[model samples]
Target: MNQRVLAERARRAIPGGVNSGQRNVPGLSDLVIAHAEGARFRDADGKEYLDFHAAFGPPLLGHNDPDVNAAVAEAGNGADLCGVGVTEGEVELAETLAELVPSVERVLLTSTGSEATFHALRVARAATGRRLVVKFQGCYHGWHDSVSLNVISSAEKVGGRDPISTGILPEVLEATLVLPFNSSQAVRQAFADHGADIAAVIVEPVPHNVGCLLPEQEFLRTLREECTKAGSVLVFDEVITGFRHHLGGWQAISGVTPDLTTMGKAIANGYPVGALGGRADLMDLFSSRPGGPAFFAGTYNGHPAVVAAALATLRKLRAEPVHAHVFALGERIRSGLTEVFDSLGIPALVTGYGSVFVGYFMTGPARTYDDLLRNDANMFIGYRRRLLDHGIFELPLNLKRSHVSYAHTDADVDRLLEAAAVAARQAGGEVQDLAAASTMGGAVR
Candidate 1:
């Protein structure tokens, strides 16, 4: 019927109907986006929707930001140099990031978040000579085999030993001990049991996997202390949280300097760029000399143009106080949504920090994977559709995360609030227990 219809029809002839699952918006069957600028994108169907998803949390400067685009274009004009040599853009980007994140004395750039996470693990393992990796449930480091286990899996599906995913081999989940988030007790117990053999404790500084789950109860403190005592490296996967939480990302916002941190997304203003940086001694594990190992390298690992885009993006972020605008917008969005939920009596709450948030509908604060499994999904499903109908495009499905960008305007905020009003009206005007629906799907349950 339309370009999106034709595109989907044509793409089904291929594999995933879409290139990567990143384009998949859960609740709403989004059409192919034709063009995006600022906080709006026009789909192939010619519908202009306000984009709250913000390219899945990158696009902090909004889509096709002129500054980043200009930098990328200028760099491309130079020599199409795609090698592992020191480029001006790369050096500037590294220095800028180091200035923002004081703990990063050295940095290694990668193509995507997965590559950074994968390399971080290798560095940790090589540095400590430990084989096991400890991870918390519901935290997604990447699609990598080692970090894929326990991510979005319920207490039932992956509790003992059933395959949680179709393609992941069983061996991948064996050594990974999935512990609950925000539980100091679990961390201590895990450390006591396998302290000597564990390589690192990798985590999403804020678990946006199953909604916006934040840290509490000295959970981060325990991890820091235990890893310091146990000779295990502490890695923070700031791929999503990087540059969004603050210019310094989660470590700066949380006041916790992870031994190693993986960052991506907003660093390059929606261009593909991921980086891993940490303590100087640990990053040296990638040296070509005899003592160190060489695990992190790719053809486009430090592509000049992308590095230039990142450099420009970082420069703009520093020069302009846009984060203040985003912080104000985030507070308004969160407050507005909470008030609407209250007035409509919908069983929902907005959980978040700074510019990132999630419309988590449930009782009290969601603290565990089991708790996320118990939140309302049906309501969010219906609500997502209504919001789309109103032309406010946030994640429709219960994606466990909502996002805002530096480009989101006051008008956009008003539109989002109006859309939430419509969605809430359809949600029976009040919050209700979604535990029953949560039990149906093995993934979230």
Candidate 2:
């Protein structure tokens, strides 16, 4: 069936024609990809698109990377859900993660980033003997009750207990304190008011959830210092920035180590895997031996095939110049986007680090979620639709960020720039001379 028909049929079985809420939004492209390889995916209708969403930021090596697939196949040869003892693949993955992330001394695996963050918070509470958890307003740790509030709330409800989903206990909301992102003073005030009861301060380092607003160096340093002084565990939720920003995660680039780190996404090259690692003294709480205070276990914590895929991904990252290539593509996209928008007399701001970025259709930089709210959302959504029409697939909505993958080539970058130029012209009501704008392609490069 075609994508629109498939979606309509899915709605009869699923809640909104999609399992993920982001995929069910209005005005999104009606596309159901049948197969993906390298930098593009083919829709059911046999149409191809250059993918910029990168499956919501997990396909760092792109779709169906041969090396990662081979490792998965090899691990699955004799793998079983024995559920009796540890697997060598899990141990090796742990060792690899420990060596890569500077803050991870010991590790525990989970199946999703949400579970990893939940476990990290549990360990923090058990170790600190406190119940209060502090998180930045715009930052997203996961969808769990503990860190779910304030992620996509309206401006007035920014610091309030507005749960992303219904049915969360009000008590769960009470235990979390939501503060504004990139504000050191707010962090200090929150810590001052409730430092003695604060268990952990979890942040996204680079809060990509709300379209990639960066943290000022002083803000992160302040978090590290304040958490240290107050005895509160600082958790860097690097789910989005883990290996995509740098080999060692954003914490390494920021030079501020957290007491706990939650990572997923690019770690397994789109496989189902999540990990929480930090100070051994803290991670040891998950120990099953007598006297351990915290509990964390998952049925598929380190499935052999998934762990093998993660190991293969990490090893390949170690051996290849993947970061340099992706970073260059990201920079090119950012600059090219700016040029396209400028040529059409449209206001835009392209911001992000390394392989991730978002284009906001507003003037000046967006430093907070509230700032992002100022964007012309309808125009941005229109621009995304235009890109899709031009065979450049980005996640729908203005607030969602886009990703550039290792599989994306210079030609892919050039094509995306060309599409953006055309999209921009269309959005600005300047499409009458699209042929002339298309001829101005070299300007973006």
Candidate 3:
């Protein structure tokens, strides 16, 4: 069946014609993907498009990677799910995580990023015997009630408890203290007021959820120092940045290690796997022997096939120049797009790090979520939708980032730049020279 018919059937069977709410885009909501391979996917109508969405950044090595697929197939031949005992693959994967991540002395496997975050928070609370948690605005931990509030809030609700979804209890909402990104003062103040009661301060070292809000070094340092002083768990939610940026994760790059780290996304190269790892003392809380207060159990926590895929993905990352290649492609796309918009005399900020990029239709220097509020939502959405029309797939939603996968080539980068020029002109109507616009206080880089 075509996309329209499939969409109708899905809407009847599924809640909103999609399993995830974010997949239900405005113009491209009916997208029915048939199959995907290296750097590209074909729709049900058999039209192929270069995929920069990368299924929201899980496909760092690219879609259906050969090594990962082979490992999965090999593991499937031997084991499916022996729920009672641990497998060799599970032990190896955990060891690999502890070896790679700077802060991870011990690790626990989970099936999804959300689960990793949930368990991390649970452990943090148990470790400190504290009830409150702190998270930054625009940093999404998961759909769980404790860390779900204050993400993607309106200007009016940016600094307040803007619940993303209803049904989260008021007390749960009150337990989370939301602060602005890049604001060390706010963090210090929060800690000063509620230091004794705060269990953890969870942050995405880089708030990529809002399309790459680079964390200020001082801000990250403050979090580490305060959490250390207060004896609270400092959790880095590296679900999006873990394996994608570096084998050691962003903590290695920043040199400010947290007590606990929650990782997923690129770890398994598109397979279903996530992990929470940290200092042995904190992680050992999950050891459910006798009177262990923390409870951690999952039937499919380390499914053989998933662990195989993760091991294969990590092996490729260790041996190959995967990071170098994707990082180069990412720089190429960011620079190329910046030049495209600059030449067109359109005010835009193409911001990202490593293999990620987001083209915000606004002035430059996007340091926080508030800075992103100036972004023109229509132009941002229009540009992505236009690129989709021209056989390039970026999720046509505001603040959603595009990825550069290992499967993408320099030629793919060129193709994206060429298409972006056209899409920019189409979406960014009647642009003025950036020089002139800057004089009027309307320019940034």
lDDT of 3 by residue, 250-313 (tens): 9999999999999999999989999999998887788544466799988889999999999999
TM-score of each: 0.92, 0.94, 0.96
Q: After superposition, how far is residue 195 of candidate 2 from its true place, in Å?
A: 0.3
lDDT of 1 by residue, 219-327 (tens): 9889899999998999999898888778787778778888988999988888999999889899888963346685556888778888888988888988998789888
Measured with C-alpha atoms, the lDDT of residue 6 in candidate 3 is: 94
- Find the candidate with the highest TM-score and give its number: 3
Candidate lDDT values, in order: 0.80, 0.87, 0.91
| TM-score order of candidates, top first | 3, 2, 1
TM-score, cand. 1: 0.92
